[model samples]
Target: MFTLGTYQVHFLTFWCFLKVKRKDRWRNGSKKKFQSQVDRETEFLDVQESDQKLNFKLKGPEGEIQQGTCRYLIGAGGAHSAVRKSLGLKFEGGDYNNEFMLGDVHVKSPQRMKGLHAFFTKEGILAFFPFDDSGNFRVIYGDFKNFDAAKKDLTLEELQFKVDQVGPKGIVLSDPSWLSRFRIHHRMAPCFQMGSIFLAGDAAHIHSPIGGQGMNTGIQDALSLCFKIYLNLRRGAPFELLKGYEQERLPIAKDVLRATDLATQFALSNSLSTRMVKKWLLPFLIEHTPLQKKMAETISQLAISRRDQKIRSNLKIQYP
Candidate 1:
């Protein structure tokens, strides 16, 4: 009946934090009742799906392998999802032209790094996001900087050197707490549903960190899918009710990918990238662009499918 596959797939995810944050509106003691249902500090080792149900193999904090099962599976495991691999779905996208570096460290500069700042230098495009008044900030740069650096251990001296490569010169960086080189791109799974199992969050889609929408989108995926699951699983709704999970959420994921793909072009751009970024959004990409943190705004303004007008109810699920 479901179009996903004979073996629909999903990995394990602990929704404790996302759940606790929304527990305020839960009626009565159900929150406490369900609180015990969450598995904290547990990691999934493997999964086996059979006859429209999923069996989980997990490692506990003490390193014991525990087993479990459920009527449904929602894959939220993220980019390297073992669940997705089990489903045999293609991620279907490629990396941007140049490799990138992102790090949060101490920055010293006369320029106010209070908000997102994009600087276009002769070498490439560089941006700064101030983490706090303590001079700690996140720096991002791209433009063929990929080399042995990708292989050798990254060092503070090397990070500063690359910062120099993208020169506007007044800034000094140090106290590197975290630094890593990676490639950004636009990617998505063609299918988000596979029969009794479904995919949500980063397991369903991923894109550039251009507007800080990765986690938000994944949260959206979870909330959207959860309600449908409740309706069918608890409310005794039609077996067909599950079909709407992918129909409703998949298009929204596609919209996010399209929006971020365009934005990533600027993120990875060297020449017109700077000017284009400034042309559309002077200092930041959030307030102006169509990449709305809430899909309600994205649908209304960004021309996402009209079906997406259904406002995302807060994590509150008033199950009937």
Candidate 2:
């Protein structure tokens, strides 16, 4: 499922844009069945937001300068977002010491299809995730100390060795497709909005990818923000309605950071506390139906909503 997940995320964010741009031009000079609806313009050079308006300085494909204005700005850019930086938003937290290595390899496993396996060894943490339904797997191993030692390119033989050392007996990995190493970081912009400007995805917050919520969280931000903006524009709602976007999302980002950090710490450490929880507490908790249901909803982001927030959706919004 790793490849499938990766493809879905990419298609949603990037491929969709490319397809829109190339729509009718690709097949022939003839007209297309469906006309592109979005007015996409690229080469954004600078942006400034203030007094309920956004001023953008753009560079065209031919390198000509242009300027435009809008009532709102949404920064979907990844980490190092220029919009967040220009607005002087604070991003708390830094990179953790742990480093993780991942590889896509053909694996022989007796494990059930789509089963996810995680192993905490003295060497660190090892995890196996199905890459697809075709018998390939994504293997990952990492910790703080080994993260530094694992900087260099890891050979296929070395990857197999590491898997053999940490993985369950009888499973073998070979025919590698890709390998890479990365570090975990937990960063959050305390506020998801500043004046008429807003941030989403990695721009608003980023955390350990343990639960696979990184992309999903960003997409959620976009969808939630868009929904609110639609109400403000089409339904004659006040501009202040946009504030709920940040109010709803920032807290979720904080919660995901906390959850992922706890999971990462527990998996990478062999402390007495971790060992006790891993050996006994974890299994017991997993058996609890209510806790499992809660976890399932959280992981799926289905539990995310503003129903509990004191701010009501129909509250009168005063524009600044």
Q: Model 1: which residue pairs collide?
A: 4-194
Clashes of each: 1, 2
- Per residue, candidate 1 scores C-alpha lDDT tens digits across 160-260 of 88777664567799877678777776778889888777888888888887656677678666766776777666656566756777887787778778888
Q: Write the per-residue lDDT of candidate 2 for residues 117-229, one digit (tens) a residue.
A: 56666666676666555667777888537457535787777777877776665677778767877888999987888777889999899888787788789988887787678
lDDT of 2 at 188: 92
Q: Write down the lDDT of every candidate, Cα atoms only.
A: 0.65, 0.70
Error of 1 at 43 (Å): 5.0
